[model samples]
Target: MRAIMGLDPVGAITRSVEAFLVALLMVFAVACEQAKLPNLLLISLDTVRADHCSAYGYGRSTTPVLEALSAEGIVCDAAYSVSPITAPSHATLFTGLMPQTHGLRVNGERLSDFGLTLAERLTAAGYQTAGVAGSFVLNRTFGLDRGFEFWDDYFPAEGSKHPSSEWMGHEVPAGFDRRADQTTEIAADFLRDSRDPDRPFFLFVHYFEPHGPYVPPDRWRKDFPCDQGSSELESMVSAYDAGLAFTDDEVGRLLKVLDEMGSTEDTIVIVTADHGEGLMTHGAMAHGQHLYDEAVRIPLMFRWPNRLAEGRKLAPAVSLADLAPTILELLGINEGAQEMDGRSFAPWLLSPSVEGVTFPVFMFRGKVRRAVVEKRWIEGERFGVLDGQWKFLTSESEEDELFDLEADPKERMNLASSYPQEVERLELLLNPWVRMKSPTDGSGITLSLEERQILEALGYGF
Candidate 1:
């Protein structure tokens, strides 16, 4: 201060203040960049079919809410799930591993902790992870709750009660799951209360309204018109649509909660299904039977308003298995993750299309059936492969059949005898997957009577 080397002290002080302001601006910029990453919201609709949704051009407005969301998101025209059941398909979605690799092929089987789950990676990266399962099939017992910090799979306050007389004699716990409304309430409350405003969060909300026993409330019943009210199949189909409507309303509620939390525009929301319902399409009611389009083809939508383009429909085939890696990669936290069976579709999410990438989606069930669905989705009793327009199927109970999917969308004609070479060629490709055994055979897992009854009610023979 003693003459300050003949310099102006005011100028030096001004320069110091300028440097501090610049550093402060840099800090603010870093915080703003982190905010752009977006929170993750995964909405899984159980037993929902791609064709039944209005977004997929169904005559009935089964999913008006979903259709609106689709308008703001990228919809995959053809997306397949690994299993026609709940647990296996969900396991695939969480772990990005096929049934063969994860070794939880059948229902009531626990998902192995061998593979890393999407929640685990995100949690390690400081994300708050939580899940609210609508059905007991995804309850904590199944090991699907490995990474979730707040797993909400508890039965309602009424407690677990057997569904009906069909489940009376079984010794399994009455896993009577809650309705879509209750599930939505839990999810919304979590969004409003549990999450820290500054941190990113990953929440999975599952709705089981359309899974089975399609009993829609009176308010949602009139959306579908059945020609014959007395016909069981028609009534079932109508109720299924009503159930979808109910679930759609719940989805809208969830979105509104996100908006209230000021995260709607900054959230990456995914709306898809574990699998699809049969609806008498393949002579089955619920899922867990065959691998038809009605059973495996599910609606997949990804919405990130600021980042993803609006109203884009992607035609490339994708599997539910792509979910984990896609989320991890998009959030920039995929380092040190185990090798995943399904590659990330993150590039396709950002761009219009990714060329020369034909992702092979494998399907497995029991010890007997395996399928390789690429280019086209083809399924039969045992094993099938679709190449271009040709579809070939081989089974022990049924004769090997082949059909031109381009011509026979309903699979009315069997061309196996006419095209023997194609059947052999396709079976050759499916053989390896068929032979891949479950890491631990699930046939012997003794289910409690209530668990057994629940699976039976869900249309599982075991």
Candidate 2:
């Protein structure tokens, strides 16, 4: 058995009225004679910032399909991820365990087999499980493909060889990622070809567009004209938005397939992102370097047609870890087989009056940085505590500064000396959370020389 180290802070809500409402909703659902278990479809948009989506009020129309889906579902307004990187963030999203407990904090590390996965639990309960991932980071070698009967990482596909260092312009072996279309086609084919119609199924589809190397489709690329030679930042944003538009169209295709199968109403569709990209926000091109809002905050939307409340937006600090447990709770599965760190937030979906409860959201970036964010308080790295509208951050050189996020989302104001007591209060909370020990220590994983090179190229400090 794989050993886990220690636990971290997680959300725990106990409301009697919410419990009653959930019971009533379940009874009503059974009374309506719906399927014993609804099919589950989880769509993860890689490196998509919540603010970029039109559903989240972005100025541009990047996610029309998702915006339409939001009308038929519930949108979590403030969803934070455990890590800004790909693998670790997805790990927490799958197992409902933080990076510290799952032992996959970095990009190249594998999730422990001992940790029970959402797919494993669903598969054990007789759901036909399959996953199609666009990025090479989620290959079976990462230990996240355990229970999926068919895990497609696109490595065996034609022209899908790992890129050589010279060709990739990096010394490390770069992974080969298929475009969103290939992933959607494969997933759609799986849905079309599944032999067992009666058995409920769970499908996980990952889209890697807009991650880095943000090259959208040719048609999408044409939407943003750089003829005048705009700033590099403008070019990057347009390319990212174009990729999102492409991904959105593919998402529509997947939903259309479900509609054609007559499972659209009976299926629970969850659309979310693993982590958001830093488009020059806080001075970063990509993710995994900082714990800022653009890096950790993501879009979490759930649609079940008539089953869940439609067009409802909840403002709460929800974590990526809550996904697995919430799915289990909705499916009426007893997940006591293994202890899970995440609690189900199914109540939020069942009742409209049940507001999103505020909870402390923790973040970890490798071993050098840790953060704790609540509704108002956000403390991490050089950026210390940001409570209510005021934010206090310390530089790497130990200089303290502060800003009012409401007035200065750009973080320009330095109110550290002005409000010394607030700084002391937030630091009191940050110190203990940051000092918490991680569960496992396998930073020295024995990787082959080629694997080590690949990790290095991906910016792992191995």
Candidate 3:
């Protein structure tokens, strides 16, 4: 068995309302001769699509750094986000709880510090915790700042500038990367200096570069084409890709420091996106508005030197929410999961499992549509369960839509009128899951007039 050191920031074990299983963890003293495990680093990129990364088969050269990292890592080709919006989706990711159960259904809502976050769980288990996040959406005010020893989440142009009655909500900061680069510097310092040698650390470094405003570093602007199309959706994707390249360079910088610190050998580093971006595949201008793959399927890569097989792709249905408990299990902080909705993939990372054990993944976008995903199918209310080969959807606002995913991965067909029974079965399966979502609750904190206007600028209450 692998021996673990004492829990630093970790507290008493957590309980899970869903899994109903308590993982027992014991601190072990490692012999000086044994390899010292590297600390854990969980890096989440804001709005990257899996299909846009070179490692995941994008024709563009968008992820050279990540592609190199993937050689020694585990990749989940079919990973999905449970919710499209930042707060709810991230809530699911941190607590391992369903958004419905966590009670944060809107962009404005924050997580309850009383809840166990991946940070809290790791912190209680004796690991030092730190967070260097890049967006206001993931701020301390929202309670996502619970367990960190040092949480430096300075929002971009919006850091201290709230909305004024005169401004239109808020303005996108002109040079977001210049700001995000500072976050990298902060995280690197935590990894190299703040870390206590006797204890390990769980650091969450999130970058918001690829999110919106479609701006990129000047050097990489032409990487993707402005001519992919004249549509806003296509241009947005081009912008996002450029942002991804810049973000990847930052990842490389962090990796270089990990190597210098001699922590690369044992560290468990992961790179993934919160959710995918929409390129008008379904006639949608932006994301967070559809449950289509364009909005939910994002890239997931886990790099743990020699602990995982290189170039291996797990085809199961996985969610970003599962990351919390899984990391806790590895760190020996085996308590406090009384309400986790995620399943650990640690065992699966070390070895493959038999088929019968599969998990269901659900995704939602507002109240518009929800999906039930299994190993071989992504079913919507209109066409029921669709194999990767076929896609289906229907609603009163529109009729029904069906397309051969194998042929129309872009989703451009309507076969609902021809498949009523399938649609009914899918609707039956989808309705119950939809009911589980918590109704939207605005952020609980009362904001100043400027804050309210800022919210309006960022696609919130108009």
Candidate 4:
């Protein structure tokens, strides 16, 4: 071949081929590194209020394990759930969509098939998926088990008898839910034996404790004793704290299993809650009645050794819906994250510092038979929007209520009347999201008679 510009054409072709091969090798190396995805262990504590946890600065050592994990992970200070109910909150967590979009409005309702879950995404990405649910509410029948290769939702039959210490007079229906210890055992077994050693795994462990009718085991209850003549609510509150301690211990056990398997360093451990308990915050003993901080704010912590910064706390508020997208992004999967309602916080986690970050978190609570609205009784759907410091709440049958959460975290004073301009401003933010149509009409799955009874016993009567 004739040389071009006094250069040998053969030499030029050889150099170009070498450069191209080097580039291809570099790309292959990057691809191989990306393929080494970390295992995921997501532990969801049902009805665990953020403020009550020791890691969140509670007076009691209620969550020592969470405290330890926070010391070695990133803690999200202002994390809220999309809905205060179990099914809806979990749906949002798994799908990165709001309850309105996911179509799981309440506890007894099933999740619509329209959305993809975190498990499904991880499974598609070549991860072995398994889930252990502590309660019947998350049973496979509810469609929360779509992508879990091994879903453990088994419960004892209704007529099965148990010791009084186990039930604790809370009327937790037999076969309705498993204790945190039982759930931990099942999850540990999966980690030890069931999971395939050759594939990365996504293990979801749900612990249903301190939900309602707080029934901590005898040992945990002894740690928090009520006064001789304390009020009924006071006693229940003590028991709730004890239940949190018990759940924390079980979480420690599960983590120990990961340690024994030598996967702790290579696994991402995220501990959070589906939703928080009302804990008599707004004259409600349980949740699903209001969207107060006590009922909506949850504990969110993530631990990945050497991969994510340790002992870092992010100040900005995030919603449960943000979790699925965040996990996918962390695992280098950006396929469908853009369509989700939640944006990932992975950038913030990797960055040295981020300031003045405030996410506008939306919340919804369907009308219950009786809900505390403006300190009075009302029955209507309540919608709320929290943008930075201002949080505005509105309902179909009551006046709008606004609170400066920065000034008053308890949300005791409603500044809506005093600050009419702010109310109007936040209403502008709330109305649009409230009007968004759901992907599915409603939870199309009908509840069997037994399921209905179980839900009613769990205080989710239809």
Candidate numbers, best TM-score first, in rank order: 4, 1, 2, 3
Tens-place lDDT digits, model 1, residues 1-462: 646578877888999999999999999999878755568999999999999998899988888888999899899987888878888899999988778668887777888877688888888888888999987778787899889999998655352323632222323355558788889999988998888776788999998887777778888887676785479888888899999989999999989998887788888999999988888776667776666678787999999987888998887677787778778887877563346666677888898756345544555544324433232233443554445566565656556667787798667688888878877766665565455444456533354565545434422232
- Model 3 lDDT per residue over 1-462, tens place: 122565533333332422233222212234432434347888888877788888888888888998888877888877888766677777887888766557876566667643577777676667788888777677666777777788876544443223222221333332223344666888899887888888877788888777776677677777777874488666777777888888888888988989999888768898888877776665554566666777778888888876778888887757776777667666545585435666776677778764235554555544434432222222232212233344444443434555555655665555567767656645544444343433334434344565445434422231
How are the candidates ranked when ordered by lDDT, highest leading? 4, 1, 2, 3
Tell me the TM-score of each prediction against the true structure.
Answer: 0.84, 0.78, 0.75, 0.86
What's the TM for model 3?
A: 0.75
Clashing pairs in 2: 5-439, 6-439, 384-393
Candidate 1 residue runs with Cα over 4 Å from true position: 1-28, 31-36, 157-175, 228-230, 336-338, 353-356, 367-397, 438-462
Native RMSD of candidate 1 (Å): 8.4
Which stretches of candidate 2 lie above 4 Å from their native place? 1-35, 156-162, 165-175, 336-338, 367-407, 410-425, 428-432, 442-462
For candidate 4, what is the TM-score?
A: 0.86
Compared with the true structure, model 2 gives a TM-score of 0.78
Between candidates 2 and 4, the one scoring higher on lDDT is 4
What clash pairs does model 1 have? 170-449, 171-449, 171-450, 172-448, 172-449, 172-450, 172-451
* Model 2 lDDT tens row, 353-431: 7764554455666634433322222233333333455545443433566566677765656677888887776555344
Highest-TM-score candidate:
4
Worst ten-residue run, lDDT, model 3? 375-384
